[model samples]
Target: MSILLILALVVAMGAVLYALVRGVIAMANGKDVSGEVQQGYMQKRVLYQGIAIVIVVLLLVVAKSNGS
Candidate 1:
């Protein structure tokens, strides 16, 4: 159970990193970010990151609660 949580967190973080890098690369290419498509992608990425953070916090809280 704990192992599953750890693995999920790792995958989530890796996905977050991948999305961030892709965004950075697109921006670096001098592509305009004002387009709706880019904005949507950015929004989705933010949502993913937010979800990841929530999951991580919850996992840590649960682990601490159990450890106590």
Candidate 2:
């Protein structure tokens, strides 16, 4: 269970990082339509970060239950 939690956290963080970098690159491109692309990436980054947070909370709950 701990291993699974670690892997899930890693994957979620990686997704967030990927979206962030893509958004930055799109913004830097300075094209007229880049705003829409950046917005999409920003949304995806938020979603991934949210998922990571939820997973972390779940892991903590599981650990606490097991300890008791």
Candidate 3:
């Protein structure tokens, strides 16, 4: 269970990274002058970060319960 949580945490973190990179690229390209598209990527990054944080909390709880 801990391993699964860890794997999920990694995937979530990767998604955050991906979103951040895409957002940066979009901003650099200046293709979306209205900034709506960039905002969407930012939102995704935030969501993924939240998921990663939640997974970390769950992992900690599991570890504590297991007396690790």
Candidate 4:
């Protein structure tokens, strides 16, 4: 179960990284057409970061509880 949560956290982190890179690329292109795509990637990046944070908190809580 802990391993599963760790895997999910990693996936979430990867998603955030992917979105960040894509958004940067879109911005670098400097085209109006890519604006919407960049926005979408930014939103996804935020969502994935949130997921990662939650996972980290859950892992901490679980570890703490188990340790006691």
Candidate 5:
């Protein structure tokens, strides 16, 4: 179970990184002058960040329970 959670955390972190880089690239490219494309990526990044945070909290909880 802990291993599964760790794997999920890694995937979530990777998603967050991917979103951030994509968003940065889109913004830097200036292809979407209206900023719509960048906004979508930003939203995805935030969502992934939230997921990562939740996973981290779960990991902490699991660790605490195991240690106790």
Candidate 6:
């Protein structure tokens, strides 16, 4: 459980970070983007990625710990 949690958290954080960086760059470049467009990207890329990664990491960690 713990291992899986860790993996998930890592994945989640990584995804969010990636999205944030990309989003910031896009905004900095002065691209014409709508509120929905920005929000959609963040939610789909960062939020979703982060959640998925965290869950996977946590599961892996927990499984390894238990097995060991």
Model 1 lDDT vs. the true structure? 0.75
**What overall lDDT goes with each candidate model?**
0.75, 0.94, 0.96, 0.93, 0.97, 0.68
Checking candidate 4 for backbone clashes, the offending pairs are none
| TM-score per model over all chains | 0.71, 0.93, 0.97, 0.91, 0.96, 0.54
Best by lDDT: 5
What ranges in model 4 sit over 4 Å off?
none
- lDDT by residue for model 5 (1-68), tens: 89999999999999999999999999999889999999999999999999999999999999999999
- Report the C-alpha lDDT of model 6 over 8-57, residue by residue, as the tens digit: 67767777777877766666766645655566656667566757765776
Residue 35's lDDT in candidate 1: 60
* Ten-residue stretch with the least lDDT total in model 6: 32-41
In angstroms, the error of model 1 at 19 is 0.9
Cα shift from native, residue 58, model 2 (Å)? 0.7
The TM-score obtained by model 2 is 0.93
Total backbone clashes of model 6? 22
Candidate 3 off by > 4 Å: none
How well is each residue in 6-67 modelled by candidate 2, as lDDT tens digits?
89999999999999999999999989473899999999999999999999999999899999
Cα lDDT tens digits, model 4, 1-68, are: 78999999999999999999999999888885648989998999999999999999999998999999
Q: List the residue pairs that clash in candidate 3.
A: none
Higher lDDT: candidate 2 or 5?
5
Span of 10 residues, lowest total lDDT, candidate 1: 33-42
lDDT computed for candidate 6: 0.68
| Candidate No. with top TM-score | 3
Cα error, candidate 1, residue 67 (Å): 2.2
Task: Compose the digit string of candidate 1's lDDT tens values, residues 1-68.
Answer: 66777787787777777777777766667667576555665676787788788778888888999999
